[model samples]
Target: MSKSVPHAPTSFRELEAPQRKAFFAAWLGYLLDGFDFILITLVLTEIANDFGLSKTRAATLVSAAFVSRWLGGLVLGAIGDRFGRKPAMILSIFAFSIGSALCGFAWGYWSLFAFRAIVGLGMAGEYGSSTTYVMESWPVHMRNRATGFLLSAFPIGTVIAALAYGVIVPNLGWRCLFYIGLVPIALTLYLRRSLPEAEEWQADVGNRRNVSTSSMLFASSRRLPNAVLAIGLATALVLIFSQHTAGYGWLLAAAAIAGFIVFAVQVAGRLVPVMLAVMATVFCAFLYSWPIQSLLPTYLKSELGYSAVQVSTALTWAGLGYAVGSCVAGIAGDALGTRRAYVVGLFLSLLFVFPAFALPAGNVVLLWALLFAMQFTSQGISGLLPKYIADHFPTRLRAAGLGFTYNVGALGGAMAPLAGTTIAGRVGNLGTALMILAGTLTVVVAAIIGFDLPARIGRAFKADDEKASSAMTERNTTRAM
Candidate 1:
C-alpha cells in the first residue's frame, strides 16, 4: 500500500495546527527542564549545608544527576524514535516532576542525590523528544530558527531560577525550589490535550511493523553517523563542563589534573601568548564576579554586609544576564550559520572570560558586565551544538542520533566540575583556573574552524532532506493512484 506523504510547512504561519501546538508543548517542556537543571546550581551551597556534606560530595551528587540524564537521553531517544514523540515526552514530564518534588522531601544527602538523579532521567527525555518533534514539524527553511527559539528556553528557565534564588529562596528555603520546579508538570497536561503526533512518526510505525527500537537507532545505515555525531557532541560537552566546573570551582583536583595534562603536552602551542592574556583577564573577572553569583549570600553576610534581600537582587542580575545571553545566541545562531555563530561567540567569550575574571572585587557593574558577556557567550555557543545535531540527521533516526551526540557532550560537561575544582586547588586561585578554561576555549575555537563544520553540516542536511522529499513525493503519488 502507498503512503500519503504530508507536505512540509512553508512558512512560520504555515506550520500546521498540530505542529504548532506540538512545538509550544515541547518548548515549555524544555523550558522547565532548563529550570529544574539550573535551579540546583543556584542552591548547591544551601543543599550542601542542609545535608552537612562537603563541596566534593555535593559535586558528586550533581555528577550523579548528569549520569542519569545521559542514560535517560540514550534510552529515551530510542524510545521516542520507536513509540512516538508525544508519549515519550509525556512520560518524561511525569518522571521529572515526580523526581523534582521528591527532592523537596529528602531527609539526607543520599536521598537528595537519588531524587536529583531521577530528575536527570526526566530531563534526558526532554531534548530528544522536543528536538525531534520540532524538527519534524517545521519546514526546512525555518528549522534553524525554530530550533534556536526552542533552545532559548534553556536560558529563560535558568533566568527564572536566578529570580527564584534571589527572591524565593530567601523567603522559603531550598525545599521550596523543588516545589517550584513542579511547574513543568503542567506542560504535560497541555501536551496530552493539545499536541498531535507527527504524521511522519505515525507513518514510520505503520510501515516498519516488526522493527525493534534498538535496530531502528543503530541499524547499519544509521549507526555510523550516530557514532560520529555523538562523539563530536561529547567533545563539545567536555568543553562546556570544563569551563563551568572550573568557573564554579566544583572539582579542584580534576580541573588541575586535566589542565596540567593539557599544559604539559604544550597544547597551548603558538596560541600560548593569546591564551595567557585571556587567562589573566578571566582571573581578574573571576575575583570580582564569583562572590556575587556563586557566593552571593556569603558576600552579603560577610563582605558588603547586606541583608538577604540585597544579596538576592545582585544574583538576579547575574541570572538575567545569563538568560539574555542565551536568547540572543539562539536568535543569532539561526541568522548566522551555526558554525560561524559558534566561532564568533566563542571568540567573544574568550575576549570576555579574562576581563570577567580580572574585574576587581566588589565592583558590581563590572561584575554584571562580565557575567553577562561570559554567560551570553558560553551558553550561547553551547546552544548551537544541538542545532548542529538536528541539521546533521534525518527524521527517521534524528532523535537517537541527536540525543546520543548531545548527551555524549553532556557526559563531558558532567566531568567539568571535577576537572575545574582540581585545577583551582593546584593553582591556588579561582582566577587561574578560569584562565585555564579560557585557554581550552581557545583550543575549541581552533578545532571548530579547522574541523570545517559548515561544509560537513551543509552536506548532511542537504542530502537527508533531498532523500526525505523524494521518498515523500513517491509515497504521495502512490497514495493518489
Candidate 2:
C-alpha cells in the first residue's frame, strides 16, 4: 500500500471552517485577556490616587500579578496537554474573567493586589492553551501568520481598554471598568459549545495515554522529587518576596536561585541548552516590554504632563502601531527565520527608544509618531514568540513546555515596573530610565536570538529539528486517519 500526502492549507483563506473557528475563538480569548490585563495599566493612576500609593508601591501591584502568572501557566499547560485544549482554553477564560470581576470589589491596595494575582493566573493560563490550540489547528506553513494574527489581539485589547477608560472611567469610574470583565463569562460558554479540540491534539491523545502521566509531567521519573522540591522552594521564595517590599535585585536573585535548582536536577535535560537560552531571551524580552506596557501611561501623565485624553490618544496610536507590526512580524518570520525576525525587530526597537522617549514632550505629533515606531518594533515582535516557543515542543508537552519556558521567563517582567520606577527616581526622568533599562535588555535579547548559541553549546538547534519531525509525523498521521 502507498502512503498519501495530506492536503495542507497554504494560506489563511484556504483553512477549513473548523480551523478558522478555532483561530477566532483563540484570538478572542487572547484579546479579552489583554483587555483585562491592560485595565490595571490604564487605571494605575486612578488606583494610586484613590489608595494614596507611591510610584514604587503602585508598580508592585503589576509585579504581583506577573509573579503569580507562572503558576497559572504551569498548571493550565499541564491540563491542556493531558485533557484537551478546548477545555483548557475555556477554563482559562472563565478563570481570568472571574478574577477581573473580583477587582471591582477590592476595597484597598492589599485586596486589589490579591485580586489582580487571580487575574494574572487566568491571563497566563489563557495564553498557553489558546496559542497551542491555534498553532495545532493551523497549517504548519502558515503558523507564523496564524500566531501573529492571534497575538495582535493583545495590543488591540489594550486599545479597547483605553477607549473603555475614556468612556467608563470618566463617568462610571474605574471599578466599573473591571465589572465589564464579566462579559467574557458568556464567551466561555460559547467557546465550549462551538470550538472543537485541535486535530493534532486528538491524534496524539492515544499515544500520550500510553505513557505514564508522571513522566509526561516531569520528563522523567528520576526528576519527579527534584521537580517537586524546586517548585516548592521557588513558590515559597517568590511568595515571600512578593508579599514584602523586596527590591527588584532581591526578587531576581531569588528567582535565579530557584531556576538554577530546577536545571541542576536535570528536569527536561533533553532541551536544556535551548530552554536556558529561551528563558534568558524571555527574561530580557519581558524586561524590555513591561516598562512600556506597565509604566508608559504613568510616564506620559506624570513626567510629560499629558492630560487623560492625550494619554489615551497616544496609547491608541501605539496600539495601532503594535497591531501593524504584529502582522508584519508574521510575514517576516515566514520569509526569514524566527530568530532573524526577532533580532531585527528587537534591534530596531532599541534604536527607536531614543526618539520615542528622549524627544521633547512638547512635540505632540512627533511624540505620537515616535511612540508608534517604538511600539511597532518592540510590541510587534511579541507576535513571533508564540510560534517560536511553541515550535520547540512536541504536541504531548506543547502546552506544558511552552507555558513553563514563557511564564518562568516572564518573572523578569515582574521586576520591570519596579526596576523602571527605581531608575526614574534616581535619574529624575522616566524617559532616560526607559532608554537605559529597556535598551540594555533589548540588546541582550537581540544577541541571544541573533547568535547561534545552540551551536556553541553543541546542539545546533535540535529543538527545531524535533519540531520539524513532529510536524511531518502529525501530517502523516492525519492523512492515515
Candidate 3:
C-alpha cells in the first residue's frame, strides 16, 4: 500500500469542478447562517412590541439560540467526523431553513424560542460541516485565506439582513423577513448535487471509526495534560458561575482566581498546544465580536433614537468592513503569524469599538467609519481560526475538534446578549454595557498576549496531511486483507 499528499492549488482555477462547487456551497451556507441569525436581530424590536417583552427578554431569544448551538455543534460535528461533511451540512441547512419558516407563525415568546433553538442547532453545524469541507479540500498553504473568505460571510449575511430588513420590514412586515430565510434551501439543493467530500477526509474515515466522542482529548497518558487543561478550564467555569450567581463585579475576582487555577493545572497538566490555540482563538475572535453584532441594533434604536433603516445602514457598512477585513487579515496572519495579527487587530478594535457605540450616533458617516473599523479589527482577528484548525487537528477528528472550539466559544457568546441586555436593564444604557464588555475583553486579550500564550501555541504545529494519508492507506490495506 502507498500514501500520497497532493500540492495545494496555486490558483482558484486549478481546483476541480466539485471542489469549486464545494467552496461556493460552503461560502453560501456560511452566509446564510449569518443571514438567518442577523435577521432575528433586525426584527427584535418588532417581535418585542408584538409580544410585550422587555429588551432583556427579547435578548434571551438570542441567548437560547446560542445555547442550543453547543449541542448542535457537538452532535453534528461527530456526524461529520463519522460520516461525511456534506450530509451534516445538508441536514443543518434543512434544520435552520425549516426553523426560520416556523418562526413566522409563532404567536408567543416560548414558541419563537423553540423555533430559534432549532435554527441554532442547524446553524451550529456550519462551522464543522462547511468550514471543514472547504478547508480540508483546499491546500494547506491557502488555509487562512479560504477561512477568511468563508468567515467573511458572517458580515456579508449580516449586512444583507440589515439592508433587507430596512427595505422589507417596513414594506411587508417582520414575518416576511423569516420567509426570506427559506432561500438557503436553494443552497442545500446545490450542495447535494455538486459538492464533493474532501479526499483527505475520505482517506482517513476508516481509521477514525471508533474514536470516542466524550473526552476524546483525554484518551492517553501522553494526552493527560489536555485532560488537566480541560479540568482546569471546567473549574474556571465553575468559579465564574459562582461569582456571577453571587452578584456582578465578582467577574474580575473570579477571572483572577481562575487564571491562577489554570496555571496550576497547566503546571500539573502539560496542556496541549492545540487546546491553547483553541482558547486563544475563542477569546480573541468570538467573545468580544459576537455581543456587538447581536445587541448593537438595540442600542442604536433605543438609546440613540436612530430609525430602523439607519441602524441597518450602519450595520451593513460595518459588515462590509468585516468582510474586507477578513481578506486582509488572511494575508496579514500568514505574514505576521495568526496570533500576532490577532493581537494587532484586537488592539485596533479596542481603539474604535467603544466609540462606535458610545459616541453620539446621529451622524451616519461618523458611525459608519467607526463601526467599519471596529468590525474590521474585531472580525479580522477571527482569521486566526482557519489556519489554526487546519494545522492543529488530525484529519480523523478535524470536524469535531473545529466544532468543539467554535461551539464552546459560542457558549460564551450565547451569554453576550443576555449580559448586555441585563447590564443595560440595570444601568439604563447599552453603550455603558458595551464599553464595559469591550474594555474588559480587550484587557483580557492583552493579558493573554503578555503571558506569551501565542508562542506556546505556535510551537505545537504539525501538518496532518501525510499522517492522514498513511492512516488511510493502513486502513485500506487491512480491509483488503
Candidate 4:
C-alpha cells in the first residue's frame, strides 16, 4: 500500500534542518546579489568623476549590465530546469563573485562597463535558480512568507554596501569597494555543502524522462515566435540608447513595443494572456523602481549637493524600510493573497513618489523619511514576486518562466537610468524627471495586477493544483495495485 503523506511544516520552527538550511543558502545568494549590484549605485558619482564621463555616459554603464540580464536569465534558467537547481545556483554565485572582483581591475569606462555586464549575467541567473530552489524546499502554505524573507536579503545587502562605501571608498577608494564584492564567492562553498537538488525538480525530471523527443521538439518550435518577438524588442531597446537623439528613435521603440503586445494577443495560447500580464506587470514595476534604485545616489550627491556619507545614511534608512516592508509584505501576502498585496503596495508607491522626489531638497531629515516610506511601499512589493510568479508554472517550467518574465521585464529597468538621466537633462530637474517616470509606471503596474491579471492567474493556479493532486492520487493507486 502507498504510504500516507506527512504533515507539512507550518512555521520556521517546524521546518526540518535541510529545509531551513536551503532557505538560508538562497537568502545569502540574494544578499550577495544586492551588494554587488547596488555597489555601483552607491559610488556612481565617484566612478563618473574618475572616468571623466558625463551623466548620460555614466547611465550607459548601468544599462550595459542590465542589457545582458535577460540573456543570463534565459540561459541559466534553462540550466536550472534541465540540469539541477543546486548546480545552477553554484554557477551563478561564482560568476557574479568573480565578475565583481574583475571590476576593481578595470582600466577605463568600457572596461568597467564590460565587467559589470558579467556581474549582471550572474546576478540575473541567481534569482531564478536560487528562488526556485528555496520555494520548492518550503511547504506551499508558507511560500509567500518564505519568499519575502528570502528577498529581504537583497536590501540587507544594499545596507551593507552603503556601510561599506562609507568605510572603504573614502579611505581605499571605489576600487576597494568592488573588491569587496568578491566576498560572496565564499558563499558558494556553503551552498554546495548545505543544499541538495530540489526534490520537487528531481521528481518532475523523472516523470518527464519518458516523454518523446519529438514532443519536446514541437514545444520548442512553438516558442520560437515568442523568442523572435522578444529578440526584436531587445534590438529596438538598444536602438533607443544608440540613437537617443534621433526623433524617429522614439517612434521606432514605441512601434516595437506595440507590435510585441499585439503579437501576444494574436498568439492564441493559454499562456499568452498569463505571460502578457506578467510581462506588463514586471516591466512597469521595474520602470517605477529603477529610477530611484539606480539614480537616487546621483540625485542626492550631484543635484542636492549631499556628501557621500550623507547619501550612505539615506540609503541605510531606505534599506531598513525595504527590509521591514519585505517582512510585512510576506505576512500581508499570506493573509490577503499575493494579488491584493501587490496592488495595495503599488498604489501606495504611486502616492509616495511625489513627496519622495518633489519635496524640498535642502531638508535632509525629511528626505530620509520620505525615501524610507517610498522604498517601503515600492520595493516591498518585490517580496510578493517570487511566490506570485513561481505559482504560475509547474516544477518543470518554474525556473525558465521565473527567469524570463522577471529578467525580460528588467528591460524596463535597464532603460530607466539612461532614460531618467536624459529626461533630467532635458527638464533641468532630476526630481521632476524621476517623479514623471515613477508615477506613470506605478499606475500601470497597479492597474494590470488589480484588474487584468488576478482572476485569470488564480484560475490557472487552481487548475494546476487540482491536476497535481489528481496525478498524485493516481500514482498512489497504481503503486498499491
Candidate 5:
C-alpha cells in the first residue's frame, strides 16, 4: 500500500529497531482493546441484572458501540493520515482508557450505554491506528505473521478479562473490570514518549492529496454508504430485539442485508479488491466469532450451570487457543496462501468447534479442550487482515481505508450477540444457536476466492525493500564517514 516504503531486511530479525518499538506499542494497544471488550462481555449478566435489562437490551449497549465504531474509524483514521500515526494512537488509547474507567461509575443502563459508545469510538480509532502502523512498518513478505501476532494479542486481553472476572469480580465486583481500563493509559504515555512513524508513511505525507473522509465516502458511489446503511440496519434490528424469534428474524435480516450488499458490490471493480473482500469476509465471520467471547461466559453459567472459576478457566484456555490460532494463521496464510489458510483452515476449524457449545454439564476437560481448539481456529482469520488491507490501499489513505473496512465489517457483525442470544433465549440451547451461524464462514471463504493480493503487490514490495535497504545502508555509511 505504501508506494515509497523502504525495503525489508531479509528477515524479521533484522527489522529496524525503531519499528519494533512501534510494533510493541500497537500490540499493547490492541491487547487493551481485547481486554476492554471481553471484560464487558464477561460481566454482561451482572450488568443486565444491575440495570434490569432483558438480554436483548443488554446486548443493545454492545450494539450501539459497534455502530459508532465506523464513525470512529473514519474520523481517527483521517487524523492518522493527516497528523501522524503516533499522535492518533496516543489520543485514541487515552480516550478508550478514560472511557473504560468512567464506565465503572455508570449509575444506569443509559449511562453505561453512553460511556460504551464513547469507548467504541476509541476502540475503532485504536483498530485503525494499530493495524495501519504495524502493517505499514513491516516487510511485505512477513506482513501476515506480523499482523497475526498483533491480532493475537487481542484475545490475550479477553483471556485477561476472563481471569479478572474470575478473580476480581467475586472480590471487588464488576466495576473493577472497567476500572482496570485506566491502566492502559500508561501505554498511551509510553507511546507518546517513544513511538515513531513508519518511513513509508513519512514518505507518502509529503505529496498526497488530502481529502476529508466524509467527502470520499459520501461520493464513493454505493461502495461506502450502501455498505454502511444496509449492514447497520440489519445489525441494529438484531441487537435491539430478536423477539420475532432469534434465528428466524436474523435469517430474514441477513438475507435482506445481503441482498442490498450484493447489489452495492456489483459496481465496477476497484484496485483494492482485497479490501472489499475482507470487509465482506469479516462481516460474516464475526457474526458467530465475536459472540463466543461476548456471550459465552453468561451462556456457560446460565445454561450449563458452571461456577465463575469454571467459566474463567474455559475461556482462558479458549483465549490461549485464540492467541495461538492468530499467530498460526499468519504463518499458515503465508504458507498455504492466505486464501486457503483463511477460507479452508478457518472454516473447517469452526465446524469442529460447534460441538463444544453443546457440551453437557460437568465435562470440564472436554469443554476446555473443545473451546481451545475452536478459538484457535476461529481466531486465525482475523490475523490475516492487517497485511491484506495494507497491501491493497495506498499509503496516504491507509489508516482511513483500513479503519473503514474493519469497522464497517464489525458494524455488520455487531449483532452476533443479539442474534445468538435471542436464539438461545427461544430454543434454550446456546450451543445450537452458535451452530446456526456456522454458515457465515462459507460467505467468508467465497469472498476470498478471487483475491491474488500478493501478486498485485509483489513489484511494489520488491522495489520498496530494495529502496529502504539502500537508504538504511546509506545512513550507516554516513555515520561511519
Candidate 6:
C-alpha cells in the first residue's frame, strides 16, 4: 500500500524546514526567469547599435521571446499537469539557462531571436509548475498570501537585471550581459538537488497516469469555461498592449474598458465586485507606470545623452520600486485582504502616473519619482492577480488555467513595446505615447469602481481566510495541549 505523504502545510510558519527551503528555491528560480526575460529590454539600444538593426526589429526580438513564452505556457502547462511539477520545473530552468547563454554568442538578429525563443520556451514551464507547486503545498487559508509571496519575486528579478546591466553593460558590452545571465543555470542544478517532488503533484501523477493530457485541461464540460477565461485574458491583454504601445491616454481608456467589462461580468455572475475593481485599478496604474519603465532608459540614452550605465541605474531604481511594491502587496494581501490592498495600491499608482506625465522630460528627478510611484502601485497590485486566479481553480486544472490566462495577458503586454516604439518613431516624439498610455489607465480606474467591487473578492478571500485561520488555530491549540 502507498504510504500517506504528509498533509499540506497549514500555515507559512508551519511549513517544515525542507518545504520552506524548496519554496524559496523555486521562488528564486522563477525570479531568475523574469530577469533573463527582461535583460534584453534593458540593453535594446545596445543590441540595435551592435547589430545595425532598427528599433522595430529589436522589439521583434523581445516579442519573439514572449511568443515563445506563450507557446511554452500552452505546451508545458499540459506537461506539468501530466508529468509532475518538479520535473517540468527542472527542465524549464535548464532550457532557459542554456538558451540565455546562447544569446551571448549570437552573430545576427535571427540567431539572437532564435535563442530568445528558446529562453521563452524554458520560461513557459517555470511559472505554471512553480505556481502550482506553491499553491498546492500551502494550506487553503494561506494560498493567496503564499502565492502573493512567490509572485513578489517578479519585480525583484527585474531589479536584479537592471542592476546587472547598470554595473556590467557599459564596461563589458551587451553580449557579456547574456554571458552573466548563465549564472541561473547553477540555480537550476540547485533546485534539482534540493526540491523534492510536490506531494500533491506526485499524488496527481499516480492517480491520473493513464489520462490523456488534452482531456485533463480540455474536457468536454470544462472546455467552455477554459475557452472563455482564455478569451477574456487575451482581450484584456490586447487592451493592455494597445495602451502600453499607443500612449497613456490609450492605456487609460483600455484599462477602463477592461475594468468595466470585468466588473460587468462579475456583477452578472453575482461574484465579488471588488475583484474587478481592483483589477481595473491595477490596469490603470500599470498603464501609467509601464510605458515610463522601458521608455525611461531609452529616453535618458537618446534625449538626455546619458551613457548606458546611467540609463541602467535609472532603470534599476524603477525596478527596485517594482520589487518593493510587490513585497508590500504580498504582505498587505495577507493582512488587509487582497481586494483592499489592491485598491489602495492602485489608487496610489494612479495618483503618481498623472503628475509624472505632466512633468517635462528635462526634469529627470521628477520623472523618476513619478515612475517609481507608478511602479510601486502597479507592481504591488499585480502581485495579487496570479494568487487570485490560482485561488479560483482546483488543483487538477490549476496550471493550465493560470498559464492560459497569464499568457493571454502577456500577449497583450508583449504587443505594448512594439506599439509604443512604432508610434514614437512615427511621431518623432515620446510625449504622445506617454499620453495615450496614461489615458488608458484612467479608463481602467473608472471601470473598477463602477463595476463589481465586492462579490468576487468576498467569495475568494473569505473561503481562503477561514480555512487558513482555522488551520492555524488548531495547530496552536494542539501545541498547547
- Alpha-carbon local distance difference test for all models: 0.60, 0.79, 0.71, 0.77, 0.71, 0.64
Which candidate tops TM-score?
2
Give the runs in model 6 whose Cα sits over 4 Å from its true position. 1-14, 202-207, 210-290, 361-368, 425-428, 445-481
Candidate 1's residue-wise lDDT over 1-481, tens digit each? 9977766554557777777777777878887887787666667778878888765456555554565665576668777777777778888888888888888899987678678778877887887788777766655445566676677676677667767777777788988988876777777787887788866566555346424345644568867765664454334333443244456444543443343233312212232232232223223322322222333333233434545455555555555655566556566766777667766776676777677656655676666666666766755555555565554344555565556445534543455455455665798755556567555745554454447543344354443353344356435533542
lDDT of 6 by residue, 401-423 (tens): 45544553454445556666777
TM-scores for all candidates: the values are 0.72, 0.90, 0.80, 0.85, 0.80, 0.74
- For model 3, what is the alpha-carbon lDDT of residue 274? 45
- lDDT by residue (1-481, candidate 3, tens digit) is 6855554465567877877777888888988888897778888889999999977778777765665664576567767877788888998888888888899889998789778878888988887788888877765556666777788887898898898898999999999889887888988887888777876578667345555232343346526664464445444443342234356436644553354344323221233344445555564545566678788888889889999889888888889989998888877776777667767887888889767777875677999999898888877667666565545456666676667556656656766887777777788788888877877877686556545554455454543343354346535533432
Predicted structure 2, TM vs. truth: 0.90
- Give the best candidate by lDDT: 2
Worst 10 residues of 4 by lDDT: 209-218
Residue 299 of candidate 1: its Cα lDDT? Answer: 29
TM-score attained by model 3: 0.80
Deviation in Å, model 5, residue 451 alpha carbon = 6.9
**How far out, in Å, is residue 175 in model 2?**
1.2
Steric overlap count per candidate = 31, 0, 1, 0, 4, 41
Candidate closer to the true structure by lDDT (higher is better), 1 or 3: 3
| 61: Cα error in model 5, Å | 2.2
